[model samples]
Target: MKTANKPRTSGSGTKRNGAAANGKKMPDVNGPAGDGKRPSLYANVIKQFDKAADMMRLDGNIRKILASTMNEIIVNFPVKMDDGRIEIFRGYRVQHNDVLGPFKGGLRYHPAVNIDEVRALATWMTWKSAIAEIPYGGAKGGIQIDPSRQKYSINELERITRRFTFALGNNIGPEYDIPAPDVNTNPQIMAWIMDTYLQMMPPHERQRCIHVVTGKPIKSGGSLGRDKATGQGVVYLIERWAEEQGFDLDGSTYIVQGFGNVGSWAARLMKPHGAKMVAVEDVAGALYNPEGIDPDDLIAYAKEHSDIFGYPDAKPIDHMAFMGTKADIFIPAALESQITALTAPMLKVRLVAEGANGPTDPDGDRILLERGIHLIPDILCNSGGVIVSYFEWLQNKRSEFWDLDEVDAKLKKKIVSAYERVQGVAHHYKTDWRNAAYIVALTRLENVYKERGIFP
Candidate 1:
């Protein structure tokens, strides 16, 4: 698959420092206060890219490609609410790169969705796939409709998804752009997209196109072990890191910030490793227990109680308190920017593993590095989703499926290997983990671009 290449131009030559060419404005990104408000998400992303580019002494041309997204689509559409009122929703999709292959990422739904967030996320996806050594580029889409506010029935959501999919037209395809699940979206949502795409295609061409969307239900051709892939991958990386550090998992305490799919599954996986989960925080509330909460029991309780609070055997705690709780490892499995400078200094953990994209802001990350916290960068740490999504896409295209055990084994091997590689890069660069990860990904992307060369 190929996309039209856009010519690169130097953006304000006066800002032509190695980092500046990467489109990062240091003064604008020094902190959330630099702008008198939170730093722009896209700016924060570019700042990191710039830091990495500066470290690598990357050429301007490659920096340009890495710094900017290849394509961005915005759509405004109306959906009939349950009250029979038509509500307008804004949606966005960003394809960051296609140098490796087609763009692959997830679609999110939230009231806070915007073009800047999508672009930043798409750029992260590009780095993520590159870091994982996956044969794919990066893209992301989101609709700015609060799923909670949508009192519409399932039919309305399906209609909204189909309409948005149609607006994408040829922009998204099995061989062009593929989207899975992200914030406020899930496999059911993906299935809606696939069904809509299939309905739009000629009947005979449908079978060849089912691979266009991933993260579907297993009955709908989703890959086995897909649901737990991301969390399991985190555990896999933790084990590898533990082995390298000569730390025992048994009796080690962990605190997970966010009791969502990634956090819950990670907690469950750690249970079998003999690791104790000391605290877990969710949108509703948080719970803590120094003796360790049994994940199985906690999960059951959360399901029954509708939140983490009020669960028997665990004391209810404030959200901020969970951040400062002492633990061997801390996993931010929640939204981006949750671990800002204000929160980082309070974290009493030695190891920080990101289960969400950009969970640590630039200032927060610097503070963590200063304090000698070993952070598993999000790109490498949470890449199991894309890796397994790649497998699911391949299976759909080939009409073959692997069993759960096979999928688990492959996911473990891939994540563990990537972890080792990133660890080596960190040591070689004598830098913190996030910068080390960026170095590894930038090197791979640069080599590919150099070999491919520019085309007329």
Candidate 2:
């Protein structure tokens, strides 16, 4: 598949200075802010990219092209609420790169959604696709609305999603750009977007456009294992890490931050391997049980109560206590910048497998590195969703369906292969796994640019 080559204005000059192109003085990566003010997400992502690019001596032209997004689209559309009120919603879609193939990412609905966050997510998607060896680039988008709030009913959400899709129009397409479920989004939301996009096309074109958005309900063309793909991928990489270290997963204890789809699924899957969940945290509150909490029970409670705060099997604990809970592994499936200078020193785990994008800031990374903590970077660790989304896309495009066993088998193969590649690069460079993952991704992107060259 091919997309129209869109020229983006270069954000970087020929000079390879450490400072950002926007004139903000670059902070010392080793030492983050002491005042606890986290840097911009986009700046942090750029710092990671620059480190890999410099380490590998990436081509200057490719560096310049990737320094900024190829397209930053913001749409403000009005939606009529169920209460007979018209509310204007702001949405964003940032296409970071498309050198590999079509743009692919997720659409999230949260009040905190902003341009910088969207850009950072889009940039991460680029690395994730490259790391997974998928034929896709990166793009992320979201609307500034709190889906969890009770003010917006289901009907309101559908209208808002449909109107946002209408506003995006051709910016998203089956072969050009595809959106999937992200934070505060589910298969139902994706189905709305897919239906909205299809309605915009004629009957003949509608059939071909079902692949425009993935993570839909299975009846609506979603893959069998799409819901748990990210969590399963995280567990797969963790299993590989255990094998390399000669550590047994059976009887190991783990703690998870964020009891969302990724966290819950990971906990449940790891249970079959004899791993135990000692603590779980979410937006509502945190829960701890030294004797091990049952993931199945906790998930059911969370579904009914909206979070894992009041699970009867576990006691309520504060965030600091949750972090300090001693466990064999820590899975941060929450928002970005959660583990910074303040929180990094509190983690009691030996390994951190990032289930969410950009969970660790640079300072946190340095602290973990200094403390001899092992990490499975988010780009490589949480890539199962996108990898399977690619499968769902293929299925839709070919009018074929895959069973759960087939999807799970294919996902494991791709994720394990990517994990091995990252491990190999880490060994070759003698760098931390995070940096090695970035290098692996950048190497692929750099080589593609070298072979393809810039268009005339």
Candidate 3:
């Protein structure tokens, strides 16, 4: 078992060192422009935390600790390509805090992966776990390579994943830090990570470490509802909101930004509610159909065509027009800083449910607040994935498997409880939902810190 407060070393015997090694420098967070007109992703995260901390009067010491990551693990590992060439790839695993429990989050693979983005996501994971009242802290990992853009063959992808896992070594463990699926990652990738991690352990210990990563294939110890957890969580919150407002979901129109796992699942799940998806957007293009585009059809087409660009039922629509489309609900499940100040004004939705982390910047948040557009913040809205991941981890630890119905019921209960807590905090403090969520999480962590005083 790993010792508390002890940093895990990589396979190379180095601990938490990567940025400055080998004459490589960490990128300037302020980008090339450096005009300060746009803040870096991590900067925006700190701003949010500061706002909630000031409002809640968080403890100075704890605030200082939470303001920065506890561990930033960077590794530059080499992977062999299909063309008989070796390429060096940089990977990151940022552990923000573990005051609540073990560090828990997802591993994403994207071209834009950077320390700032990973740090921001890791910080959010800590808040997400606290808000959900789960016994997990926060962490996030990523490899700086676009799985699609790089055109890596399956063999190359598997090799890269295994090499990255081997590099992570003890830094990730079933009880220390567990990774699940995020952007451009899925069960197959998770299986590779788990296998690679298991192979690094003794034969007897390997069996106990099947859950070194969550979101694996069910046969590989993944949970039944794990795949749809985040989207299901999003829909659950939306359902609760609709019930509270006495709004009929039947025949309501909605738009989705990003047709990936979360967006597609959320859209498909909303079908039973009789809701219609009128518009959808992704990295490639946008689609619109006032009569409603079928989620099942779009997803199937996307699976085959690799995008939602040419679905016959929906006509091509520009981003501006798509955002301006009349709808009762808008789900931004795409990249960070998507719904900025410029795009926020174009949204004609009654609600903005963030499925992606940091989809709204400070300026966009102000616009939404000013426009009275209700929002279910990313921390609370997209927490189902982690909640179900917790369930999976528990199951693996105990050698048990739950059916889909059981998983869904448990997820609903946990997320709804969190929602109620946020709602109560919002009502009590008379604040926005985002601020209310942070307050709830910060209050929980603050109490924990008070109870378990810091060790010398």
Candidate 4:
């Protein structure tokens, strides 16, 4: 696959004193460049790879190959709108690696989706799966259309998905690139992709193609406990951490940012564990009550009202205040960059469990570290989704479905075991969890790469 040239600013805008620009100095992955200030996603991914490579003393050739995506497909397809107009949408699917198995990751639907962002996400998936000891690689796809805008009808979305899937062709398969649900995408969307793939396959091929996609509804061969898998996994990690620290969750408090699938389910699971759901926030707004809000009641209310703002049981709070609220645990399940340096120090919590990818900026992470708050990094905390997605893929390939209880048990074991491994590394290295996790994952990837060696 041909790699796109890295974007460069010409003339005096370039920095001369920085590390060599000829791939000698690894790019700054965390530097701000977006909006001309935050670093681009591609730069961030490269920066991370460079850091891990340096620490592991990786070979130059392997570093370059691992740093660059193996495949990136950009699609500019036209979809007919409800008003009889053809709207051209930009979509991207990036496969970072397939060394372990077929690439696996989520397909997000949002206006902010970009090639750089998808590439970064796919790269992260590679590390995440490796860290979790899963037999998968990394790939990510996204349509740059905002689902909130009713510009496209359901039929149009289906058409777009089918076209994108078909465009992928042999690039994706039951043992190739498997796309699951991500931000703004759900089981229904996965079902659409599966149906579309089946429609294009022969009868015998269809049977083998069911594993091509995961996160489908259970009735459609999806895993039974997949819906709440990520959230449950987060709760499991929190419980393990609490036990390690001797913190009882019975009367503990939590502030959750994001009321979507992960956040909502996390609140519900933690509630039954005796944790008080004091604050829940989403794009609509935030709701808070020091005495504790019932997750069951809040979920029902949000279902009916579409937002947590008008819930009579809790007082409405500003989004900023929600972050600074006092709680035992604070979960950023909304989106990346929600927790920053400004918000990190203000958090009156003992732990920050990331439910979203890259939720904390580098600066914010430093602040949280200075304050002695334990951070259960995104790679370890939010791995449940992918873990169950792996299970779903396995069942699809074997044509054997497990019960909900079985799935849940397996997920909890995997997540808790991964958490303990991360914690052990943190203690052994005497470093924060994030660095410890990066070390652990980097070590695993490096070892595997060495074992496999180079293919001449």
Candidate 1 wrong stretches, greater than 4 Å? 1-39, 77-89
lDDT of 3 by residue, 278-353 (tens): 9999888999999999999999999999999888998999999998999999999988888888999988999998
Every candidate's lDDT: 0.84, 0.87, 0.89, 0.82
How much RMSD separates candidate 1 from the native structure? 8.5
What residue pairs are clashing in model 4?
Answer: 29-44, 32-37, 32-38, 32-39, 33-37, 33-38, 33-39, 34-38
Candidate rank order under lDDT: 3, 2, 1, 4
**Candidate 2 clash pair list:** none
Measured with C-alpha atoms, the lDDT of residue 49 in candidate 2 is 88
The TM-score values for the models, in the order shown, are 0.87, 0.86, 0.87, 0.87
Over the stretch 316-421, how does candidate 4's per-residue lDDT look in tens digits? 9897888889999998898888878788878999999999878998889889999989899999999998999999998988889899889988998888888888
Each model's RMSD to truth, in Å?
8.5, 8.3, 4.7, 8.1
lDDT by residue (276-315, candidate 2, tens digit) is 9999999998889999999998888888988877688889
Instruction: Report the lDDT of model 3 for residue 98.
Output: 92
Which candidate comes out best when scored by lDDT? 3
The global Cα lDDT (0 to 1) of model 4 is 0.82
> Tens-digit lDDT track for model 1 on 101-208?
999998997766666677788888898888888889999988866565335577778878888887777889999999998887888899889988998899999999
